[model samples]
Target: MKIGLYVLSIVCLLLIGCGDEKDSTPLVETTNKNQKPAITSKAIEDFDYTDYALSPESEEALANWEKYQELAIQIGYLKKADLSFFNGEIEDLKKFIDQFKTETPKQLLTNSIISRTAILETMLLKLNENLTLENIDDKLKLLSVRELLVAFSNLNYQINKKLESDIFNEIQPE
Candidate 1:
């Protein structure tokens, strides 16, 4: 009976020890903060403007809109980088955001754009507040930030298509 109990206790201890092992990989690193990831040329190539039949003004606006999307991707990568290098990138991102805000025609402000702008602003505010690594809940916070960037990108694409349609309707002959 004593031998059986000892064997059962040893097995339980072994199971507990195995359960406690954790992977040692560091979640986020600060080393590559300065390097912006390459923006793939294919992203722009994939956009089919020819089929949209956009007016000249709409085409110009579409270019600017695409520029904003590219900048947003850069900003997303910056947001993922180390805290030390985030401020400079944030300033650059703000400037890009401001350019679209001020230069894009007021008539192009769809309800979707307004809602997305508000959400993006909120996410930026959260990011700024949690800039330090110590403050972040690694998985949850990082995932939220990533989701926000994706939402912004998808929303920006939709806004571009809507703008093209709106502009095309304005210029089309009745």
Candidate 2:
């Protein structure tokens, strides 16, 4: 009985140890924050992006309207990367996003518009640098897209923080 109990304890310890195993994959380093794990391209692509569901833009263009609309648009473009089955369409996505800058009311500091925007530009440049669809199997290339949900969340937080003052509480419907 003593031996059986001892073996059970050993098994329990092993199980606990296994639970703490470090993730085998490493993510690309992001300067956005110091506390959270640097999100990897693979992890990013693997994430469920529906959480940032963007609704059709309200004509009023409320304070958060830009964040919501852009997120939806960004996700649609990113799907191209996912369908490639690897990193195949990353370059195309980058080109589309890069050349897509347009002036509009909801354009916040973190949006693709405003070349001077910080986080948007950083993400643009990073996506451009990685996720190139070159020479690899189309299926294999699909894996390069990173989870943009985190990136999107970060942008929302930044936008809210920066626009707290000037942002209209709720734009009155015309």
* The candidate that achieves the highest lDDT relative to the unseen native structure: 1
Task: Give the Å error, residue 43, model 1.
Answer: 20
Cα lDDT of all candidates, in order?
Answer: 0.57, 0.47
| Candidate 2 local lDDT, 42-99, one digit each (tens) | 5445666544322223223433445345544655556543333223356655554554
Q: Once superposed on the true structure, which residue ranges of model 1 sit more than 4 Å away at CA?
A: 1-59, 62-70, 79-100, 167-174
Model 2, stretches more than 4 Å misplaced? 1-71, 76-116, 133-144, 161-174
**TM values, all candidates:** 0.46, 0.35
Instruction: Kindly give the number of clashing pairs for every candidate.
Output: 0, 11
* Model 2 vs. true fold: TM: 0.35
lDDT of 1 by residue, 45-157 (tens): 34333322334554567565664555555654554453332334666646756764666557667777767666766665566545534556544445544554555665556
Ten-residue region with minimum lDDT total, candidate 1: 44-53
